[model samples]
Target: MTPRADPLTVEVVELIGTVVARYYEEYEHAAAEHSLTGAQARVLRLLAHEPMPMRRIAASLKCEPSNVTGIVDRLESRGLVERRPDPADRRVKLAAPTEAGRATAQRLRDSLDFAREPLGELSVAERALLKELLQRMLGMTPE
Candidate 1:
């Protein structure tokens, strides 16, 4: 049922997978340094941008809402995240990062040596091109 990809396409897919795996590996290591799991750190990072409802977070994380509840519970206990009734819908709860949580997220981003070192090697134009190419590959934006 699957169509074969060209050799170049297959190789590119494999390389992307390898790069993603290594990035996650490095991310987990960085997360451990802060006494957090990758998932916890990820939730913090997401909340650092803006609050999100439990269902939306579950959808984004590709997990069940119950799973997100547990993650939120843990984060809440750590004083990193708080649950408040959604202003848009009183029946729903939103998870938001505290000031401490935002600071931790920033620190985690700052400590990502894996991302900084190699990407820093590229010129600004090269980085822009790479970003454009990756965004295109993911269909994230219009050309």
Candidate 2:
């Protein structure tokens, strides 16, 4: 039989879900002003960082390759991103953001300035503590 989560685990999961939902809502609103959906904006942001193979993009987005293809197709249609043959392998396609897409990603990131407000409520010490705790929970490094 499958094991069930304890009450504390369930509560923590619920809290995480709530925070993620709120963050996404804010991002969606900010992104909509630039005529991009949250998923599309996310893809563009990833592309802005570096070119990635379609399979890697799908893995990062936790979606199927087919879904990533559709998202890339829409972005390409908007002239935000383009697909090119990977330099190392002609058979492999890579996604790269255009200048317009990089600009859009920057604008979208600037619009969703959530950290500037509520985070301001915490003192530097408290912010450090919170960051340490959250990083521990996520199995990540604070830096």
Candidate 3:
């Protein structure tokens, strides 16, 4: 026999699930608006900060390396991404975002208004409290 969660806990969990589902739905819509699949848009967004090897990218995306290869292939064909030799190791290849890729990723991010609109309504203190609580729940240092 297992102990049951309290009412507040159950409600919080359900709200979290709802938030995640809504976020993904909005992300998919934004991706399609840019004429890019969710996977391609995600990869491009991941590369915005720095180039990453295919294996690392696959791990980050939680997908197979071959799938990342296909996504990269499509993005490369569109002149959005380019593959380059990893400077640290010649044998490794890194995927980097081109100017267009960066622009597209920025646009995609900008178009995600689902959370932004609601979050914008939060006061600074309330927003900080929410962030801190969420970080704590995820076992991260509340910074």
Candidate 4:
């Protein structure tokens, strides 16, 4: 048996979905300006932090390994990423962003401010409260 959500809960969930979708759309447009697709830009962003295996990237992006291969291939051809054998396991390959990739990723991040502009309208205390509430909703402990 399914339990129905309260009206307030439903409204909240719908608003969250709408906000997330809008953010993605804005991000995609920003990425396009850099000659990268949303998926490719996401891969660059992920690799900007550290090297990761194709499997892990696929898992993070909720896509298949084969799809990741193509994305990685494109990034690599553009000198945006490099693949090297994992230090822990020589058989496993890890992908890391190149210098150009890192620069592009940073640019992409700096260019996207859909949330930043609106969030800036809130006071510091309000922003903090919103962050805390969002963390709680995501089941994350405050640092």
Candidate 5:
């Protein structure tokens, strides 16, 4: 026998799911304006931040390495990113964004301005409070 999730828990989960879905949808729409798919844009953004192993990217994307292979291939074909053999371990490969990729990511981020309006509604104090609460919920320490 297993206990059922409480109604409140279920509702919260559904709400979170809805919010995430909406967020992604909005992101996709914004990315489309720049002639980029959501996944491609995401890859560029990730690479801009740090070089990562393909396996690590696959794990983070919750997909198989083979699936990530296509994404990498497409980006590489566009000259947006490149894979290089890790100096420490030749067997490992790391993915990094090219200058073009970084520029594109920056442009996309600047164009989206996703939270500009919504965030504008909050005062500085209110924004700080919201940030603190969200960080706690996400199990992150506030800086």
Candidate 6:
């Protein structure tokens, strides 16, 4: 004997999956338009805030270290990112976004207007409710 999910639960899960799939499609398109792969764009965006070590980047990206190395290699070749020695630990390498990388990341983010197009149709209150629900689903406190 096995427990079965409620019909409403399944429907909600499917809807969420559909929304995420569409979002990724739009996001990847934006990245491609900027002459960057999704992974490279993701790395540049992550480094926009602060420098991070290669291992930490791998953890954040949820990928193998080797994969991150190749991504970084490509980004570095484009002069989008640069690797520097961690000040505290000479053996560790940190990746920092260059000025060009920041600009490219910003452009990609600005170009991804998929959610904005649909959300624009909602009332302010509806948008607020949607944001609250999304935050709750992500296990984040409403700000």
TM-score of each candidate? 0.92, 0.82, 0.93, 0.92, 0.82, 0.87
Q: Which candidate, 2 or 3, would have the higher lDDT against the true structure?
A: 3
lDDT for each candidate structure:
0.89, 0.90, 0.95, 0.95, 0.83, 0.90
lDDT of 4 by residue, 8-107 (tens): 7788889999999999999999999999999999999999999999999999999999999999999999999999999999999999999999999999
Provide the lowest-lDDT 10-residue window in model 3. 1-10
The C-alpha RMSD in Å for every predicted model, in order, reads 2.3, 3.2, 1.8, 2.0, 3.3, 2.4
Question: lDDT tens digits, residues 1-143, model 1?
Answer: 23356787788889889989988999999899988999898888889989999888888888898988998899899999999989999998899999989999999998888777998999999999989999998888934
The superposed Cα distance between candidate 6 and the true structure at residue 88, in angstroms, equals 4.1
- Cα distance off (Å), candidate 4, residue 37: 0.8
What is the clash count for each candidate, in the order shown?
A: 0, 0, 0, 0, 0, 0
For residues 8-77, write the lDDT of model 5, one tens digit per residue. 7677778778877877887898778867889878877788898888888888878888877888899899
Please say which candidate is ahead in lDDT: 3 or 5: 3
How well does model 4 score by local distance difference test?
A: 0.95
**For model 4, the run of ten residues with the poorest summed lDDT:** 1-10
Please provide, for model 6 over 1-143, each residue's C-alpha lDDT reduced to its tens digit, 9 standing for 90 to 100: 22236787778889989999999898888899999888888899899989999888899999999999999999999999999999999899999999998888888888989998999999999999999999998999976
TM-score of candidate 3 on Cα atoms, chains taken together:
0.93
How does candidate 6 fare on TM-score? 0.87
Segments of candidate 6 deviating more than 4 angstroms? 1-4
